[model samples]
Target: MRVLITGVAGFIGMHLALQLLQRGDEVVGIDNFNDYYDVRLKESRLQRVVDADTAGKFTFIRLDLADRAGMAKLFAEEGLDAVVNLAAQAGVRYSIENPLAYIDSNLVGFGHILEGCRHNGVKHLVYASSSSVYGANESMPFSVHDNVDHPLSLYAASKKANELMAHTYSHLYNLPTTGLRFFTVYGPWSRPDMAMFKFTQAILAGQPIDVFNYGKHRRDFTYIDDIVEGVIRTLDHTARPNPEWSGMKPDPGTSKAPWRVYNIGNQNPVELMDYIRAIEEALGKKAELNLLPLQPGDVPDTYADVDALVQDVDYRPSMSVDEGTRRFVQWYREYYKV
Candidate 1:
């Protein structure tokens, strides 16, 4: 299948592109290469994708999702079989500082994607959602069926809006759309702003690492490979209407239309302190902790219920935090020569 992956220079996008290329799928990837964190890291990821495309199956384009004309032109020209919409301004805390970024990228940009998929005869539209949507809902294991009307941040609200936008397209156009609510995704080639990467960097530099919420936050840190696998599986399995869905008791995860949402997570929540210990173990260096209060727009804990994912995809994330951290630390050392 020929796939169009937005944010192709992103951590998950790059990894997903390589996997698709390796499996003999033609890929057209696009990214704006914004200076959110480090453009060099994004460029390196794209370069890796290019190097892996020995069969000439991958193409990279410099494009932003917010550019309506550019996105329309690419969609009309590419003749894509499927689209994985992964491009968005992706930091939860950053949204507090720059709310407009989320509106432009996540809301307006995603509208363009929906229009493209609706018109282009794309069989499946698989997009990324987030665990942060479960804000203020003290549910133990966050389930897609639960109501997510109380989002704490603009970023979370934008993601929830994406799911709503996709469902509208699905119902109106019979488009098969699936939204994967990703947990705290971490592994090699991760974003520098993420906790794992920052902690590692600070620990190696002998600097104090800020422990948010006084090290009380728990997260379901799903590995990148696991997330990629789940995404690929979901992309292949085009969403279908649930026959049993009733309007009387509407299920948030599924609808009468060809739209569905699933939580793609490890289903294992780890405390912040334990996760830090894993990093310390990986690098053989102790981190000086500066305990801090939880910042605004932050959740105390997040745990995903991935039973729907397992049932539909026949896959479960098996990577433990310890092993995943070790692999990331190894990659970090090699990537930076530290």
Candidate 2:
């Protein structure tokens, strides 16, 4: 399969690209290498992907998703068999600072992706969504069938908006669009901005770590391999119109159109402090904790009900936090030459 994976320089995208390449799939990936956190880190990830090309199986483009004309040209040229969109301006706190970035990337960029997929005769479009969409909903183990209308943060709103837009395209053009709402994902090559990475770095450096929600938060921290596995399986299964969908009692999750949403998560929520402790234990150090209130747009907890994903794809994100953190810290130390 000729797969176009956007954000191939990202943590998850790079991993997925490696798996796709290892499986003998021809892959074309795009990433603007935005300095959202560290462009160097992104470049390092890109390097790994480029280096792993034993058969010259992967090609890359330094393109921004917001550039419609640029993306349209690539789309017309590639004749893509499938699209996996992982690019976006991600970060809830950062969204509060620059909301326009979210609009540009998550909203405008996603629109371009949909357009490209539609015009290119793509078979299936598998895009990244977030568990943040289940904002303000005090529900345990959020299910795909649940309503995600009330997103607390701009980032969450953008993700929810993507699902809606994808459904519109699916309904209009019969595009098979599947939105995967990933929970707290962490592992090797993890983004430095994420909690697990930050905690590990801080603990090792003897820096104070900010414990959000006064360490009362819980998250279903999933490992990267499990995430990639779920993605690969979903890529094989194109979206299908829900036979049980009714306009009279319409479901926000499933559609009369060829649209579906699934939560890709561990299905096991762990406390925030425990997650920090996992990292601490991995590094054999204790973090200087500065317990703080949960910031605005930050949910107190996230638990994903992946039964629908398991039923559809027969996959689950089951890596324990301790084991996952161990892998992450090992990678961090080696990657940083610490």
Candidate 3:
């Protein structure tokens, strides 16, 4: 399959692109390489993806999702078979300061992606959603079937908006769209802003790590490899109208149109202190902790109910924080020569 993967230079995108390329799929990757984190890290990831595939099955394009003309032209010319839209303005805290960034990238950019997929006759459109969308709902485990009308942050709101937009396209154009509501994704080459990356960097540097919610938070931290596998499986499993869906009692997870949403997570939610302990064990270094209140726009816990995903795709994330942290520590040491 020939696929177009947006944000291909990003942490998850880079890993997903490599897997797709290794599986013999012709891949066209695009990213604006914004300085949301480190552009150098993004460049290195892109280079690694290129270096890994000597077969010339991968192509990288420097394009932003917000570039309407460029996106239109690329979709028109590329003859893309499938699309994996991972490009977005991420970070819940960052969204509070830069609300417009979320509007431009997550909302406007997603609109463009929907248009591209609709017009290009793409077989399937798999896009990134977020677990944060389950805002204000204190359910033990977040389920796709539950209502997600209240999003605490602009980032979460934008993600929820994406789901609605995708449904419109699916209803009007018969475009098959699947939205993967990703949990706390972490692993090697992880974004520097994420907790795993920040904790690792601080621990090695002997700096105090900020323990949010006084280390009371819990997260379903899915490893990158597991996420990539779920993505591939979901992308292959094109969205179809749920015959069981009823307008009388509409299921938020599915639609009468060819649209669906599934949570891609580790199912097992680990406490923040436990995750930090795992990192400490991995690096063989103790972290000086600064226990802090939960920042605005942050949730106390995120537990994903991925039964729908497992039923449809026969896949589940199983990597434990201990093992994942160990792998990340190894990569960080080698990459930074620490």
Candidate 4:
């Protein structure tokens, strides 16, 4: 399969690209390499992808997703079999600070991806949505079928809009589209802005860690490998119309068209303090805590019900927070020579 992955320099994108390459798939990846976090980390991830391409089956292009002409040209020329759209302006708090960034990358850029897939005859389009889309809904285990019409942040709103836009394309063009609503993803090479990364950095630097929601918030912390596996499985299984779908009783997760959404998560929710304890145990250091209230646009908990993913893909996430945190700390120590 010839796959194009946008945001190849991103945390999940880089991991997914390497996995595909290992399986002998031709991968064409593009990333604008913006300064959302650290450009050097992005560069290093890209370099790793380049180095791992022993079969010379991987290609990297420095392009932004919002660039209409560039995205169209690439899609037209590459003859891509599938596309995994991972590029977006992530972070709920960041969206509040810079809402325009989300508009350009998540909204406008996603439009370009949909257009590219629509015109180029791409068989499958798997894009990243967020568990945050379950905004304001007090559901215990957030399901794909749940209503996600109320988004707290622009980031979540953009992701929801992407799902709607993808459904439109799928209905009109018969394009297969799958949106994976990812939970809290954490592992080696994670974005510096994420809680796990920030907590680790601060703890290692002997600084105090800000405990959000007074360490009461819970999240379904999923490992990186599990996410990549779910993505590959979904990519292999093209979206199909739900025969049972009806207009009178609509399912937000599935449509009459070739469109679907699934929650790719561990299905295990961990308390914020418990997660911090895992990190502390991994590093063999106690963290100085600055307990604080939850920030704006942040949810108190996120627990994904991945029943559809398990039933469809025959896969389940097995990594525990303890083991995942240990691996990440090991990677951080090695990478930083600490």
TM-score of each: 0.99, 0.99, 0.99, 0.99
Candidate 4, residues 1-338, lDDT tens digits: the string is 99999999999999999999999999999999999889999999999999999999998899999999999999999999999999999999999999999999999999999999999989999999999999999978999989998999999999999999999999999999999999999999999999989999999999999998899999999999999999999999999999999899998889999999999889999999999999999999999999999899998999999989988888888799999999999999998888
lDDT of 3: 0.94
Q: At residue 112, give the lDDT of candidate 3.
A: 92
The C-alpha stretches of model 4 lying farther than 4 A from their native spots are: none
lDDT of 1 by residue, 1-338 (tens): 99999999999999999999989999999999999999999999999999998998888889999999999999999999999999999998999999999999999999999999888889999999999999899978999989999999999999999999999999999999999999999999999999999999999999999999999999999999999999999999999999999999999999999999999999999999999999999999999999999999999999999989988889898899999999999999999999
Higher-lDDT candidate of 2 and 3: 3
Q: Provide the overall lDDT of each model, using Cα atoms, as 2-decimal numbers.
A: 0.95, 0.92, 0.94, 0.95
lDDT of 1: 0.95
**Residue-wise lDDT of candidate 2 within 312-332, one digit each (tens)?**
888878788888888989999
What C-alpha lDDT, on a 0 to 100 scale, does residue 259 get in candidate 4? 95
Model 3, residue 158: displacement in angstroms? 0.4
- Candidate 3: count of backbone clashes, pairs at least 3 residues apart or interchain: 0
Per-model tally of clashing residue pairs:
0, 0, 0, 0
